[model samples]
Target: MKMIIATLAAVVLMTTSTVAFAEQFEVINTEGSSVPGCQVTNSCFIPHTLTISVGDEVIWKNADVATHTVTSGTQRGGPDGVFNVSPFFPEDAFSHIFDEPGEYPYYCLVHPWMKGLVIVQDAMADDDNAETTPPPDDGDQKSQMDEQRATPTYDAEHFVTTWIISTPGESIIIPTGELTGTYSVDWGDGTITTEAGNAIHEYDDAGNYTVQVYGDFTSIRLGGDPTNAVKLHSIDQWGMIQWTTMESAFRGASNMVYGATDVPDLSNVTDMSHMFAHAHSFNGDISTWDVSSITDMSSMFASATSFNQPLESWNISSVTAANGMFRGASLFNQPIDSWNTSSFMDTSFMFLDAVSFNQPLDSWDVSSVTEMSYMFTHATSFNQPLDSWDVSSVISTSSMFWFAESFNQPLDSWDVSSVIDMERMFESAHSFDQDLSEWHIIPDGT
Candidate 1:
């Protein structure tokens, strides 16, 4: 299923930013490492000792629940000037470029027991047996003495991808079988006009390159390698790509964030599920995006911890599924009560764990919604008047405000005639002591 979506997106898929010559590697601060047990098991940083070639990039991903740092030096000696990452939270990442060759040791300053080492080797050494030549000017410039690197074969399995150009003479396979519509590819170095299948150009030098494709297509897999983005940095263009296939285009590109002033054309788009889910550092001002045609918005900004833009001008009249749209978006707190949701439904998990969200929602027309499960669970700051909302159409309000520590409002006028399940709807909501003596519950069996 992933490959199919990737292939469809391959038609207009273009990786914008230029990557480095050396390959990228990931080091994870493994799950359940915040406690003391991980240090005893030597499982603090997965592969506590990582060996890589010079010029390679190492991305440290925090998969643990607690915040951590990737600081250089030992516990006693303190931090060396190697590479130090400030406090980064779970699902967030920090990358460092390694240019010099050496044995660099690092540890978490907050947790001294968590230790790791990076061994950088000079991969392009001037050997006695190999001959070297100047890099050809046709492609990216190759580093001196980088001659013995083997050519990378293109994989047919991956139909859609944002490439990280490592070695020269590598083949970039574009599925000519798909892409019936017109599109163009700017392969960073230059543009490729011809729609060739596998006979794509190979660089004469051993450096790096990037690409951007724009055309009409079915769908594109959300960018990055599922959960992590290697070289995805920016979206410089949206081109003339005409389609609703931009679903999950930048789902997990943690590196693509901020200073994004370019507003994309979304007139042709409809479904936008998981569009920016887990894009940790993205805080681009897209408050004016034309999202009127959009319908499904499930998980669009889920886990996008840095996104906090105004959405008051958005026309959500056509939207339906809004479940998990702002789940885990801790910094998002904007007034969007003015959005028209007359045709909307399914508001489950809309603000789950959105800790900083505290806005007025009494004006929202939620009369058409059917499922309102977990709508404000863990939204610690959400406390507003919801008695004005007409929830007669809602069938499930399960876990709606669970753990919302600050929510305390009147709900005497709410209609629960159609509700079937209200299980744990107000559990752990510390300040919620609303009287519901006038309300009546309708069981499913009835």
Candidate 2:
């Protein structure tokens, strides 16, 4: 009979121990009861520092009839909107699960003096059953909050479109739609559809127009159509493909298009070369482009007459070759001092007919240059300092400053001993006044 009593007492003790270990933590007032307010003697239940294993949960019960709150520290503050609570009220409870191992401090929003600490131990200590309880609504609320912090707004009044054409003239409204259906011509009176399925617009006068295209339109090849001379205005936030070399790659003629008169939103473009070649009237600001992914800018603004945007801020430091990059451009006068030309090899005629460029270029590292013939022949006003340039690897200087009519600077420091040609180095330069006593040998043996 005594043994039976002892066995029953042991079983009861074990059951009580199991129940206590199952609950991670419980917060009650000083009285130690499950009631809202603490004991009369101790009004507050202070759990200053708590050390729990990963996946452990902590529950805060409103021991006092007054309202209270639980707010995590700034470092691990969960969501921006739900970071605070009100007065300590009755039956108010807040709970949080510690899934990550870290030191998290929290406090009551209503009473700054009330604080708590939670230290979550690493899960590796107890490998088994470390999974935390998922939130009641899963993670839907957190996901929505993250997305709301990301999207940008749009503007309509500041948007404009400018087009460049092959022929000299005509006016027309470009219809916006998926690249399908018969092409139509808008002459301000009525719309006329063509049998060739090509939208034909006529502009008898010479001016610019701001065209608007609404909705989702894709596969658009701007300035590729032979009879089209329109340049889409600002790209704003839209995605568009401006130019191409292949005729069949777009809906218009490949070679007939001349220029791009609009500022394309190249925020989405990975390449920007040859997008404005043969364009004569494209003069817009492109100094703020993010061209980090562009690998080929071969003839980007070649022959563009009015393109004078500064590109000194671009990360063209990775460009390896700049062959004919700005061959016939006439109005590009921005400084190229910020360019990293260490990887560049081909700079032949880079500024061939660029007449408006007279900035100082003494800092350019041309150590890898092998050709300089005709590079500055027609550049009339470009007589800056070229004394410090290393032309040791140069093989040709034939017509370098031939037609440069305003070149009167000294070239005594230039090493032309290894140059194979100096044919017309001073052809039409009527303003030649600098002494050539230091010149190794005149091409005509003068």
Candidate 3:
């Protein structure tokens, strides 16, 4: 089952500027070493070394849990005047351009042993002719070499794209060359629209935002502060896409995304435990997402107070844990009777303080669940049918219905033989007057 065994570690660095570039090279810091070509014990920067033209750019992306730097120079020599990175966290990246022809060796200040090299070459040296015509205009004027390099190279997996904040609360997006399709845009402020000439948008407040674009697109990276958007609107094909398909794509966003109309496909997602833990403004229509691949749904909607959408059609057969799935969700009372809970092993605090939940779950198969402690603590409106549930596998039912004022269901037939704790099972259940003469209780560790 999908589980969040460790928290995602990173330090996000914000930027207020953008730069144009030519060919772009990527170096990812994954696991303990760089990937795609880099290895540890010897060469740490995948490719270890690289050769590029004077105008090319190289981007270093952090894919590990720890921080990494791309300081220019070796450990003993210290940092050079070339480049250096501020503490960048997981999924963070930094780029630099080479304009001079020379050999530059770089290393990571955090991990002194990690190193890399970049060799810059003169543009004219690439031509076969010893003395090329007019020295091939170099940025000073338009030349034949410039036209040759203009031919765009598109990736089968990712379409070339770029975006920038046009002004306060607005952004200008450009999907250049080869990629053609009417796309939909989610401004990340409870608003969505279609892409026109140069996709533009405005936001309500001034803060960091992630603009999501979908349609004939495979990869999306919209990073900017859309504080200067206009009120123009249009529609396109956005129903076929699911925005969270990529890995850890929207980890800690608060009000950045809202409404069900903007979420894309989720058939391939595995870990979504804290996807929206503290997102207090998300009440979107994501009931149609395929959640069969998910295993860890703990705290998925913990503090999302405005969410009350229907999720009865979701297939949760592979789920194994839902520790705090609805801890503080105060307005969720949807019918989830059709959920497949046979593989659930942990439901601790699943509905800790959900004051408005009272759905029927009589047909649920919960034979594999072992922890139901505080499952319905403080759930004032929950009084549903759960008599047919096979909870013989549960080990902790302490405070299971504590403070559940309206829960008066008859549980005399339940096999509580395996429960090791039953303290405060019905502590403040003012409405519970059912007979418990047939209960088979036991203490912790016999």
Best by lDDT: 1
TM-score for every candidate vs. truth? Answer: 0.60, 0.45, 0.49
1-446 per-residue lDDT for model 2 (tens digits): 00100110001111121211133565542222334343243334556678886655666666554544455542112212222222224565444445558887655433434556778886453345456554565466444434432332323322223333223465443433345343222232233334222344665543333233323222234444434432332232332433222111212222222122234444444444556665543444566665654555655677765467678888765554565567677777788876766555556566678776777777777777777777776787677878878776677777777778887888788776667777787788888778878867546433
TM-score of 2: 0.45
Q: Across residues 1-81, which tens digit of lDDT does each residue of candidate 3 receive? A: 111111011111122111122467777655665343343445566666888887677777776766555667554344444
**Clashing residue pairs, candidate 1?**
14-212, 14-213, 222-248
Give the per-residue lDDT digits (tens) of candidate 1, residues 1-446: 00000111111111211134467788989987877878887789988999998867777778888866676765434455455544445776756656679998988755668998989998764475246543364144232212212222232221223343335665444333232355555565665564432225555533224455644333444453553343344443443445454567678876453322345567877878888888775666678778888998889999987678788999878899899999999889889999898887999999999998999999999999999999999999998888999999999999999999999999988889999899999999999988998898755627
In candidate 1, how many clashes are counted? 3
Clash tally for model 2: 29
Q: Report the candidate with higher TM-score, 1 versus 3.
A: 1
Candidate 1 ranges beyond 4 A from true positions: 1-182, 190-210, 215-219, 227-229, 258-260, 443-445
**By the TM-score metric, which is better: model 2 or model 3?**
3
The per-candidate count of clashes, in order, stands at 3, 29, 21
Higher-ranked by TM-score: 1 or 2:
1
> Among these predicted structures, which one has the highest TM-score?
1
Candidate 2, which segments miss by more than 4 Å at Cα?
Answer: 1-226, 229-271, 293-296, 435-446
